[model samples]
Target: MGAQEDAGFSTRQVHVGASTATASPRATPIYLTAGFTFSDLDESAAHFATGSGFGYSRTGNPTVHAVEERIASLEGGDQAILVSSGQAAVTVALLGLAGAGDHLVVSEHIYEGTRGLLLDNLARLGIETTFVDTSDLDAWRDAITPRTKALFAETLSNARNDVLDVAAVSAIGAERGIPLVVDSTFTTPYLLRPLEHGAAVVVHSASKFLAGQGAVLGGVIIDDGRFDAAASGHLFPHLAHSDRLGGPSYAEKYGRRARGQYLRESVAPRFGPSPSPLNAFLIGQGVETLSLRMERQSANALAVARWLEARPEVERVDYVGLPSHPHHALGRRYLTRGSGSVFTVTLRGGLDAARHVVQSVRLITHMTHLGDVRSLILHPQSTSHSGRTVAERELAGVFPGTVRLSIGIEDVDDLVADLDQALDSVASVATGGRRTDAGTRGSEREVVVL
Candidate 1:
């Protein structure tokens, strides 16, 4: 324990944040208690004064801290804070930076849930936002004002596969003394590390790819500790100014650790976004196989995108792995390992065709989530993007025909076969064609398939 070990990712992921089990179990034990006990009055007083240990589960817990350390180690960050959901992670991360009257320059092509959170929920709190095209660095620069606290974006846009040039965008934020907060939900650390490229903070919807099995809900915020906290301390009086009793400011006490501490000690706990210890355990189990699942999923996605691009029923394939995609080159530059597996396919037949394909996919699940062991599909315009205006939907690549696909680790050929039959169903219905046994196919998961 005297020296840090530079272990490879696969090794580190499985071994990091290992708790000392009472009976030597190989897996991390879940410390599911709502609160911890101290041996004596001095011990409790010491804990409160130093903030070095756990007391209440709402503020901290050993189980959750283990998972946070693992994610931070994987993300190459100083520390991480776990929250209840991806939306909670984004909310806490932004609220830690901006408050009433503060501004944020955000990407237009983000998850509709996140968009609504910013434009609607946060607006009620007096925070303002200016959405700009993520790829256009000039617009990113033009949107920054004196009160702008952060440049928020996703590494690979949600639903669509538009790649954000992180290095270029971070440079602009650096010039304006603002941190770049990236939602890496689409491209987890296995596919990309936003901090190494230039982002100051990275966030994820751990419920999706991190859990990898769709069994739990969790989120994380990883801080690289490289943002200029000293310069921005003036803007954040909580970290810059002294307490009422005239103690040193958080910046003076924690320095580079202050931003993450603010989120941990103040924002997240006050907002009550604490994750369950059981969910943290599930996310940790999922992280152990993250690299393996991501590799298989990315390869499967590329194969499916190619297949879709060659089909007459397809209008456009919005996967970055395809050469035809506008961001293919930028995707290559950033996502050299693999372009993420979540993408969209626009059908030539519009809404009806979308409905047919979504309903007919026997293998892929019809759900709203991405990043699972099983492939999933959704019709965006009528589902995730339904609340957006026509212009807003168009900006996010959500046409009546656009369908989002999250490729999984299923056999690529089987996935293709499912899509082929579904697309064929669309063509058949269009030409007044009928096929026998259309409604009788069976699945093992048919507990109630009506």
Candidate 2:
């Protein structure tokens, strides 16, 4: 028998989407072929006509479908679509909801790549975005106009570590009948579920936490099945429009599943952002131990944050796990498991100090990626946020002296030692070596040496 409905998250991650092949394989078997064979002409016609069976890998693969189901189950969503990359998933989700002349109200504290997607790529497409300070609910409300289709934000924002008030934002969208799309990449379903707080869709960079080992790249869009595209004809007129065959509209055809089916049937396929079956298999394998990895990674991150706080070279530690962080209370309310691991550190010594610490880290690999089994670091101003202006960068909490850390499931003591060495390596112009503040290194950072 399959897992029970009330099974734990850890149990579900390991078992919810296991293969049902007659051979009874314990793992999800990767269906690596480009296409599936049809038994007869009628079968092929029926498959295309009704969209019932697997036709090609681009549209559907058993391996990809299995992982999709697993993620949907974990996120408390009705359905999910796995895509080529995180950008592709965000593109598909946004494109499905908006088109030419449409607009989106987004959180200012988002990934830089996405900031470019809205301000650059989507702008060319004639769609616009209004960015608001995520903590200001009034800004979110005032930004919405007649063209606004969705309110988008990260559950726990990238780099800055400010926790989103999902309930507050989603309530604003709810009042306006606009669906809320949340990027839960920073806080995976293991730590938070956006749907539970009234978000209509949850997006993830499966390459991060979902594929914990960093061996594969993938993304997923999970729908709560609550947003009725047909209800708002002014915005989603396409859903209400009839087909060439004069058939019932998508809302009439799929009932509550209209939004999900539209993305799966209309948007995802036409855009061609499908995930490779091999990648899907790898993501599924990584997901099996997601809860375990997240638990350890979160714990390790808190220790590192505490350690960073006491450094003379540090200006501030943005990890919400720490009480000193601005969003600690918000994180406490929402991220009950642990405050997220991916956060930024601002150096008092400025850009020179950032360069020194980043170059000196031996254990923490200097990379652009996050949520790996091994710790990683990045200078956002030079890498991810380099395209933006000084003002834009500062708005998103990207500063010249700041470096983002994606904490991994490593020994807390070892991670602390590595940071201590790296931060201590940052030389002050006055001292000509590690900046030694008299009171800064108090009580060895107060973190438990796990």
Candidate 3:
């Protein structure tokens, strides 16, 4: 099915890839078998050579395929590949295009885990990377070297909530003949499809908003199928020469599906990070309500950001949806629907005060994970970015007082009230001010019209 058809987003989510020939189940079934039996020797040889059908669960499965198809349809990509985790998806996507001696350009404000993977793991492999400010197109241009194979950035940076100029970056990549790979974990396909904005490849950490309920861990890479491998052969030698797969080059075999095919057949099998059929099924179920959850979550997050911005204890709030945010106009231009649910705020009293607010919250859980039905809050300087050096953390905009909040589907009034109490408690302790009167405890909760 094509996206141009009469089918809407909600309709596609519900009906796409939910049926299979082997089973009559209305839902996508978990094909738990390790290997598929071939009818004969000729069929086995054909399947092995062309990958026309599933041969091993480590490589492919019906349930996983269903999830891939659904995600590809949602993102408006030519094809998609599912992996075990978000990091795995990122690693595979990078490795599929680049190798030893090649360089990549990445946003400094990306997820800390991803930054670590690129800086540490890929560096160890002799794949060099240059980190730059994603908002600046000139920084991206200056950082691109002859060895640069791809340009990578997040649609909405984790914790920092920085908005990437997708079209500008895509234009730079186009001029340089490099594919632009965007991690759209924060925004999800419901709010913004990166491919539609000229990104050659789009990735997602399905563990976040895509799964919605945070019940499963999975990742996906979608191929926009627009980049020209022939013109950029030196940067992407894997697509140019495929001696490992019996001399059939990736571009020659898969054409526009080259990236997805390489990720599925070569990278995923060797890396052994393929998603389980059950996990894929859970992700498929999560996609059905992605639009609804994102809408409510975005609205709740905007309300909470506004509330936090007005609090005296909050030094600053870093939600792109907020007018006071540095990238608010850019977010409005690129992110038409909403910025995102995950954002950061700094406390007036630094780490101690930030910790107090985190501890005082009643409804929002003080956990590391984001995009759940239950709200979550965390301090990145102590949690996700703890491993980084002081200079590195500062470069990534992770201040000691910074607190990340992943707003959920809770009632806005209740969420605001919870935050108000937490901020008040933090203020009382931070400033050495004692809670004295009845108004101090429940003043904000009471309705007072001027």
Candidate 4:
């Protein structure tokens, strides 16, 4: 409403959150102060009573609000709330709805950190979780109980690239009057829009692709304004009843914005995970080029995944973009832009071989993070998922020899060359000498499909 309506994604990203008033900065400037000054006592009292004006940095800030508004627009949500990190965004979103004695049905293929949050932290708080197969629709239906408050899953899983069926799961939640919360970190809005498929809320770890660079740590929760409070009043009494004074319920007062308002006013402030204004500014800059980075990264990832599949030394390739993948059809249907840039490659030489490739790579950095502009490689078995049991690691497609790669926006030829050199090092160790052949590098070799 502020600028252009029916604008394209690129135009919206650059201009959506910008302030248009005269003398306003073209970019969202960082308001680094801890608090704002009020004109008088009446204004301060009104700000505290309504929770509208920014009285303190913990509750809200101008710079942070700009990022929130921009994300909400790009994601096609009614409102958004930015937090310190992706974990905080997820924590606040769920805690606002579910509490002690409540339950949630979650996908088994999500990030391990989120899994730990559910099992280690939320479990102690009396909230229960049921993990089900990512693509098993009937299993998701059966897992929901009478006390189930929400259905949660990732739009695309980490390392393994298991594409989630958003529409199918949302339908299941809709039948039971439950809200569907999805983490769209891997599949950014450029690749897929979860809200259009009936998801009630979308969350992201903006530290990843949304930032387009691994510099800032931020997260956002986008509420689509469709998780009807009155319709699901029985399950979510918190949104339907007012306990703070004798005012109207959140639903009745805010109507379509009930969930988002609750998250901003109640959960996020109580959790005290306020995002830094500087971080918000950097994240907003990243959004300006999200589509460009995602397109290049997706193409680079597909090329590398195909090139890896052609190598005899490789045991398996778990990229959903490849036709050999089990979820290739789902990826094609949901992720028309690209399957994503992060995926795993299994080696025939086991953990020792993985260590060799991890150490030999010159261009691909061996790091714990993903979605960087520079390509990154990591040994998930020993690093990111090390805390998981052997069976859990296997289920996640992480073996002793498995290596996760997050492809960057670099030229495809250079990326392939770097991988070729690293794989050659592994080949040297495996064969006791370097065996060079163009056909071996280009030929389609049999790979273990999963």
Misplaced by over 4 Å in model 2 are 1-22, 428-450
RMSD list, candidates in order:
9.6, 9.7, 10.3, 9.6
Q: Estimate TM-scores for all models.
A: 0.90, 0.89, 0.89, 0.90
Model 2, 99-178: lDDT tens digits are 99999999998887888899899999999999999999999999999999999999887667888999999999888778
lDDT of 1 at 330: 90
C-alpha lDDT (0 to 100) for residue 17 of candidate 4: 65
Location of the lowest summed lDDT over 10 successive residues in candidate 1:
441-450
Q: lDDT values of the candidates?
A: 0.86, 0.85, 0.83, 0.87
Clash-forming residue pairs, model 1: none
Alpha carbon deviation, residue 287, candidate 3 (Å) = 0.4
Model 2, residue 429: what's the lDDT? 34
Cand. 1 Cα-lDDT: 0.86
Q: Highest lDDT: which candidate?
A: 4
How big is the RMSD of model 3? 10.3
TM-score of 4: 0.90
Candidate 1: how large is its RMSD?
9.6
- For model 2, where is the 10-residue window of minimal lDDT? 441-450
Lowest-sum lDDT 10-residue window in model 4: 437-446
State the lDDT of candidate 3 residue by residue for 235-255, as single tens digits. 677777776748878888777
